[model samples]
Target: MLSMAWLASALIGAFSLAVHAEQSHPAGKVHLGASERRADVTGLRPIITWPGSRPAQLGQAPSASTTAAPAPPNFNLNELMRSILFPNANVIFNVQIVDPGEKPKGPPPDIAANFSISGWGDNLYPRWDVVSYGAVGLEESAYLLMKPDRLCQNGKPVPVKREDWIKYVAELSATAKAVYTASLARDRDAVAGLADRLNESCATCHQAYRTG
Candidate 1:
């Protein structure tokens, strides 16, 4: 039996193809004589229109001469750093003390206990999802931080010209990914060490960028 996700994807693809077919040739008829159609597992046939015909509209809107209004920029560096990156990074960092290899210790202290993430689930992985989220956020945020036109909240631009900033951000991303990898492997020492590496990266960048 097909999963709900697969079924949803198939339905969406079919609907998209149907819309394209309707828009391309005419109201009722679809002209695929000069077009190529491909069959997939979903049993939906993709339609490709011929040259010199009206082009099919896909994800983007079909435009002739009108210019679309510019989208307002939503996020600046300070906001993103504070709102998204900081909390997520802390989640992964918090688990640094856990030693997966050691025999089960007695109940953890109230502040340090793993509650719902107790490794008693059917999959038996403890808080793997949370660790993965932090890893992905760190890796992705590095790329976003380097976006050409990103600004700080005070209207100053990110220091793209500073080589050290770039290098440190890259290091942070790499170390976060390494931490994530170790977490997935349940390697306690590796995760602990790499989390420290991530901290070093953060400190170096803050020294260069953060104002007193």
Candidate 2:
């Protein structure tokens, strides 16, 4: 019904309108259909945009750098036991006989004058915080015991791979965790009661491993 020239002109006008509509919008904006625009405007759905590729998607494998933890440092088993375990165990044991909440007697020592002493002005014993530290040290000692390439005093490798050794370490860690929990509650009797269990855990390990 229409002439060829009129039909061509109508087509050109439609193309120009489409081009203008596209140009009017800001760059990087997705052109939505009428229904999508209505949904977006009504807040039914939000549009999300990222500057680059989307961050690690769910179920994606992690990068190689984040795959494994660094190796533990090599340390002597005997020194670790003496320095970290023995001293901390003593702190736990002391709690059985002494009340951690009790304040130190007399005036605090002059720190400047007695700086040479290891604990100078600080309370040397019976502190709830120290008890917690000791317990934590004992618990963490289990990990140190299992350290790769650890050696005992007599030049033999630590029996970390042995089943009995693993069991003893687990017992020590559990008792130590219990001691720490009691220490946090400031329950002196509770901590005191755990001393025997802690001692037994240590004694069992020592009997099995420390004997020459």
Candidate 3:
């Protein structure tokens, strides 16, 4: 009887451990277990510098210029701006999640979500709101600083026009704000979409704005 009791206890302990492992492995925003890391928004290490270096301020929204609005250019600033720009949010809230499904016994990683990463960020990033709102994933709101016309360090006019650039900045910043607001509302799809929009804008702008 004692042997049987020991066997049963062993099984229970093993089962408990297995359950714990599974809970840890599957769920929102896990950083430690995955073979490769994926960003909540962009799936890559986000650039987190621009402020301290005091990146040059580009021109702002143009006062109504006399130039007439021609048909939209064949190239897409919406696409580029949405891709190239990246905000320096992590500088403020550099969060990470080690596991998702499991309720951590003692403190867990910096952040975790039950359903998806956006939700995780909703809770985590907001905690840092008073500190910095940059990583808040304002749609297409991010841009690589000092990348004039995308020539960046090349010192040349970006193929894009000044007006388009300014317009995109407004669009991205506004979009990110709107999206993050939606996330705070617990709207998952919109929140995730905004993250994508932010990443896409940063990449696209970098390409067109960068010197070839």
Model 1 residue runs over 4 Å out of place are: 1-53, 57-72, 98-125
For residues 110-136, write the lDDT of model 2, one tens digit per residue.
Answer: 855654334621343336767887887
Better of 1 and 2 by TM-score: 2
Best by lDDT: 2
Candidate 2 global Cα RMSD: 26.0
Instruction: State the lDDT at 142 in candidate 2.
Output: 88
Winner by lDDT between candidate 3 and candidate 1? 1
Model with the higher TM-score, candidate 2 or 3: 2
Model 1 lDDT per residue over 40-144, tens place: 223453455769876553434557675575564478888989987898788667777654445556965463254232332312323554565577788888877
How much lDDT does candidate 3 score?
0.44
lDDT of 1: 0.67
Residue 201, candidate 2: Cα error in Å is 1.1
lDDT for each residue of candidate 3 in 1-212, tens digit (9 for 90 to 100) = 45757755775686677668656753223244234423333444444446566333333233477456644323333343344332242222122221112243776555323334344345442232312244344332344321334442344444444776666566666665665465344444554455566556656655655555
User: Which is the better candidate, 1 or 2, if ranked by lDDT?
Assistant: 2
